[model samples]
Target: MKQPLIIIIRSINFSRVNKERNKRDIERNKRSKMVSSASSSEAKIISQCFVKPKTVSETSKDPYNLSPMDHVMLSFQYIQKGLLFLKPSDGAIKPQDFMETLLQKLKDSLATALVHFYLLSGRLSTSVTDDASSYSVFVDCNNSSGAGFIHAKSDLSVGDIVGSKYVPLVVQSFFDHHNEVKAKVTELVDGVFVGLSMNHSIGDGVSFWHFFNSLSEIFSSQETIDNNIKLFCLKNPPILRQVSTGSVYSLPFSESPKSNPQFQTQVLQERMLHFSSEAVRSLKSKANQESGTTTMISSLQSLTAFIWRSITRARKLQSDQETTCRFVADSRPRMVPPLPMNYFGVYISLVKTTAKVGNLLENEFGWAASKLHHVVVEHTGEKICSEMKRRFNPPCALPSETFYDPTIVHMGNSPRYDNYGCQFGMGKAVAVRSGNNDKYDGKVSAYPGREGGGSIDLEVCLLPEFMEALESDQEFMSPVSPSSG
Candidate 1:
């Protein structure tokens, strides 16, 4: 494959001053441990309930056509996962009391949130046209479906999972389906762990966080006449504009006769690397220095560039080989009029940056960071709309094929999303994670840390050999501490 041209390049020397600065940042982030080690305590299922809306209007009973973006997402056929861990309240509340109160609040707030966001409670269905040859997939908002809620109890404490080397595998069982809201609340000796799994087809990360924030708002609001009345009034009501299907892209669907042949033969390892706020600052500073420009580098851009270089070096690809970095950018702000904050559907576009393996590995970190920044800056409102209009053209195949290519890296999620702010009456979460089973080699997930600082946690998956080399690479490991799973 032909590599994309480098848009910009500026060089600066790496000196002792940069090394000393990084060393100081690392020391500032170290803290003493306060929790016991992971125990053998297993979370036992207590109860399961289908949480339905309190009221479904007649207008809500009708099925709606899927937006053009939704149709595009239907091709992926994958569900996204999110897990949040909360410490116990600071009072003298009993475990039983806390569990009962938390479950009730969750159920009530979920029901209220579904009233405005009813599509989440619906199912994905396909209908044949009059010709019998054509079909369309849409959301059935008949209110016949509901989100799944599960309550469980665990003997482990909050410390066992938070900051632990590996996240507990029990977190995967929380959600039953992608469309359905699957939440598992495990009662710990001194805290509670909440896990949520959602279908990616329904909405992207922005929409997911909007719903979560609304749910938290409803839960935290005091019960009163005015508050109850305002609960149904949304700040930004969801508006489904008529999307032209002609502009939407369609991918060929081909079924492989061989079953699980390729996946069964491969080995992938998932690991979490925690980057402190100071570490991110250090990286941003180093990246800026390398650029030899006054242009400020974002934490995401700098870290991504650093990781991409580390991976390329670890994989040890040929100098002439081509490599690509892919990441998703939110399209709402890039749209002409800009979509509303509450516009709840897939509103994201993929960004792919490619370069020769030799150039990428031999260049200063600023070159990679500048390339990433250019990609983001190039996708303006007009450009994104134009791209959407031309979606029917042959889609780029590099990103989807990255999982099989050791030279390709795909980044997922963003630290811009305030995932840690998903408080449900309790204080902020101690930690948040993507489910264990959601990991894929050559893919990386990034999220804001729970420490309220500007830190980031990178959930990385790679082939065993590549991961081993990455862990030992001094430059990459300098600012990161790995959490093995």
Candidate 2:
């Protein structure tokens, strides 16, 4: 038996829901195109369409400019997430009937949800400065095409996917994308797969989950409060534009840099390892006690340090070679005055901590963790704003080390997202999966364990050899909650 793997997929979808049988089919065709599948067993897009908001808002009609933070992440791949659910209990709803109900509910609710998240339905535009030194990006709200929604089915069961040792290729290139925000629902033999994907530039994980939750909330509410628009008071309406002041402002990209060929060609193995709350606490306590500090090191910092050492050893890098760890910190609270929770789009600061592989491997776990803690602390709102002015006066091209460098390890996503809360009136999701949108070697996406209680699942991507070595490392493996696979 293998331990249940819960993937932290970062994905999104929306569209109009009209009940005219023939016209719905015709309109679906006119609004979106059908995608072809490679094989009979693989998932196929039966229908596709762009989803727009039900109510038009004059406030959202203007072209919305993306903030500098958004520009900084324009080159990154889209965030893709998926949730899995067993069919409804009683098996009363036939597959076709259940799917039809789900499809309509999602579409109708997504349209309502889009009223609040207008940017999802819009297109991204970029323009170069007259000096030809830089460019700016914005969302063309007026020419909206709506978010992408696709209905697909496959023969794969939960076991066929989660039971595999590695991510199957079929799940990697499952859907074709056209809109900035894309979504898919694939009905498996034993369960349903709901996926959401969005351009990284549009938002970070915070915004992504918020929009997704809103859609799910709307969809689920249809059973009772179906038409009570006033009842769906947005807890925190999203503020899409940058609201905080900065010392200086400039875009991060010299140009929207093309996708890295290295990332595309790289062969990586992904493994999701679970660490219980107790293990994390023990790791933290031991790290702090060893460092002779009581309060400075956090659970995440300690775990990160532990993994850093483990992976460096696994890689067998030379003592003198540099090993860099880069992770994101929320910039909203770091903003000069601190933006509220509803602040949307990209507002994140990437912090990097580097050390010689030998130094990291030889040092006590506390030493490496202290470096990560200090680097993250130094990345204050003031420093973040100042970095903007310094990074691109004349537009400095992004260094290869920023992303494609082999010596780099990037830790992303948080374990706090309400991933399991995406219930669509079918009770709750039994599992979660991350799609292969921007996967690469040395990437770790963290998510809250499905069983909760401070448990965390790190979906780590490494070369096949690296993964094997990592799994065998006693120091790292000891803390991992065992799985059957």
Candidate 3:
């Protein structure tokens, strides 16, 4: 297997804006005694969610087996530089306070919760990771560089690269920045950009949203901060029992996308959009009442249907085969007493939905959206256990084999993304962006803004032809469905 190219630039030098940071250190030491030690706490969290694999065959499935280069799979990298919003008189900011608060937030965060158990064993044959321990979760802080800034990176696996990569994180940050904090911070060459590398086998864009939001919750709150915090409680982690056997599908990697002779290296686009959270919520409410669909399914369905219709219209192509959209489902409740929140591992499943292309181009957007909603709900059922087992089983010698399909489209969104309160002593973030491999050519993602009241920030990545068509339609550019508000 080929390894990914990774570049990491780190610097650590920080100056406090408030009173003597040493005074806060003393206070932190006092708090440390009150909190549990790192070794014991991390160990407890690990045990709460993971059990040692029963056999060697299971070990090979660990995503870690793919090598460290694989760690770079679905990565979205960004560099933020600027002065952040900091009111010295507002209150005293403490480092221990930030760490402790973040620790607690990780405990309840859906991302931490799902990762704890799923990453323990090995790679799951389907969704993301099958093993939890094989995964790595670590963050590097930079305070020494003369320029004050932060860098962030999010990784994806072979499956998600084909779909658009930049869409998820950009959308996530947009929603987070506009809806939750509403604080205009900073976006410069010296700002901060956080990075996370995980396999799509573990979770999808939605799962990423939940995890990021949990982190933001911790960063913004000074009251709930505590040094010694617990991240996961084992009240049925991994939710494996809830998974069914019928919906699983085999994805043979025999056939992959051929590199185009005309295309060279892929470069990503970076931009920031502002929206109010209030607008997003209102749209959700309307969609639920009128179409009887969950916010996740309804919004995504509309976006996918619109993109497909526009593309087909441009190509002058027509077909009866249903267009498909696939994403992921985090599975972390199958264990008794659940897993720890910060257990960094993979544990997620895939959910695929298909709708007829003709039905999607209908005049009534709601009607087309509802059809997509139904398709998503019907295909992602929890009755595919046998199917999952068969798909992941070790390969066998055969004259003929099935191949992976490149045409299958996958879409997802994380309303929680825009919520990461990335505030250092300086200010807030000015902008955030993301991108990925060719697999995500037509992928679309959504996220909330820290200040946007109800409207979510959206990102769409498509082939040049498809993108041109979408841009050609003014409605698609501002196409927030009535249900989405």
Candidate 4:
């Protein structure tokens, strides 16, 4: 494959924030441990209840069908997204009243949004086939069941969160999901955090954000919602029609998104690494210049290679050891006839590239990047459909080894996910984070930088030693300071 270089680079020099940050981070890291270790006792759940749609559709009484893609997704856990927001600036409102209003508005708005996307209110269910050979899973739409909504609070302050070098493990408490979708709003001093956990079978990234955007719009819009269920976002209502894949299944009969994931045991650390636009441009320019292929090299492609290389180097593996880099692409546009952008389901294609540790570390940056570029471009419509069908037809999950391997690195989520715009009348979010349900060593999530433009934020999770090595690697640390984001 041929490509250019430089999209997002790795490493950060916190020198800009404080010349003494190295010493300060050490102290802060110790304090952070104390806070996370004890804060579980401080997280309080005030109330929990299912929020049904304010209105119901006649067809909603029927079971929501699952596509081949949704079936394969059943092997995975729930998709979790959490956003951090600055509390509305108006101080005139009493704290008690503010908390009361925020919770009520969000709950009410969520109910309203559920009316349009009623399938999400259903629970996962299973049924035996007539042949008695296998079973199928689907959404059992129930009028009484809807998205789970929770009201929570914590003693930890906003400063205990975004201000630190690593994300606090305490944030995971804000979300928990099974077969059903759920949302939680935790009131903290000076800021508010909202978390949403959804069944991966229910939808993909587009569907997930559509529901989020709907809730935010309803909450912020002054249009008073009546029992009639005022309609919003008329242009792009969700399309839940099942897409056939000509694939057979011997899937797990259980009907729910697994809250817990199985993985190797290790002391892990998570940090958000930011690559500013200038640094990204420089990396890309340098990478493309070296490869002599500017036209094919994309910022994202280049950035992925940069992250893969940096993390591989941190592992300090043998020269002949193999490393794998995997990422997913939306198959909506890759289908032969092309699925609608709003078509709701897990229409995705996975792209994997492998290389010898010696080759990747020895070659110029663009060589590793082109491997990713070539693999992704080769994933045509036919191949995507084939992969989706063959992925889970035999009723299996990716071996535990795929996630636990020290030489393996995987990236998920997308920078284009409009996460910062997922507001509930609280203005734009200042920072965004994910829950720990699916996290493991080498698990990485990508988000658009708060500063926007072409910058990127990589939420990385690794073993303590691996993370320490990554932070100390000057080769990857030379380009930028993550604090600017």
Question: Top lDDT: which candidate number?
Answer: 4
Q: Could you tell me how far off, in angstroms, the CA of residue 209 lies in candidate 2 after the best superposition?
A: 1.0
**What's the true lDDT of residue 283 in model 4?**
79
- Preferred candidate (lDDT higher): 3 or 4: 4
| Candidate 1 per-residue C-alpha lDDT over 155-214 given as tens digits, one digit per residue, 9 for 90 to 100 | 444544554443433333333333344555665556566665555667788887777677
TM-score of 1: 0.81
Error of 4 at 85 (Å): 0.8
Q: Which stretches of candidate 2 lie over 4 Å from their true place?
A: 1-41, 127-135, 174-179, 226-231, 242-264, 392-402, 483-485
Better of 2 and 4 by TM-score: 4
Model 4 weakest 10-residue run by lDDT: 1-10
| Candidate 3, lDDT over the whole model | 0.34
Query: By descending TM-score, how would the candidates be arranged?
Result: 4, 2, 1, 3
lDDT for model 2, on a 0 to 1 scale? 0.69
Q: lDDT tens string, model 2, 346-409?
A: 7777888999998898878888888888887788889988887686453333533457677878
Q: Residue 203 in candidate 1 has what lDDT?
A: 77
Q: For every model in order, what is the number of clashing pairs?
A: 1, 17, 142, 6
Q: Which ten residues in a row have the lowest lDDT in candidate 3?
A: 39-48
Q: TM-score for model 4?
A: 0.86
Local distance difference test values of all predictions, in order: 0.63, 0.69, 0.34, 0.70
Indicate the worst ten consecutive residues by lDDT in candidate 2. Answer: 1-10
Candidate 4 deviant stretches above 4 angstroms:
1-42, 130-132, 177-180, 224-229, 233-235, 243-264, 394-404
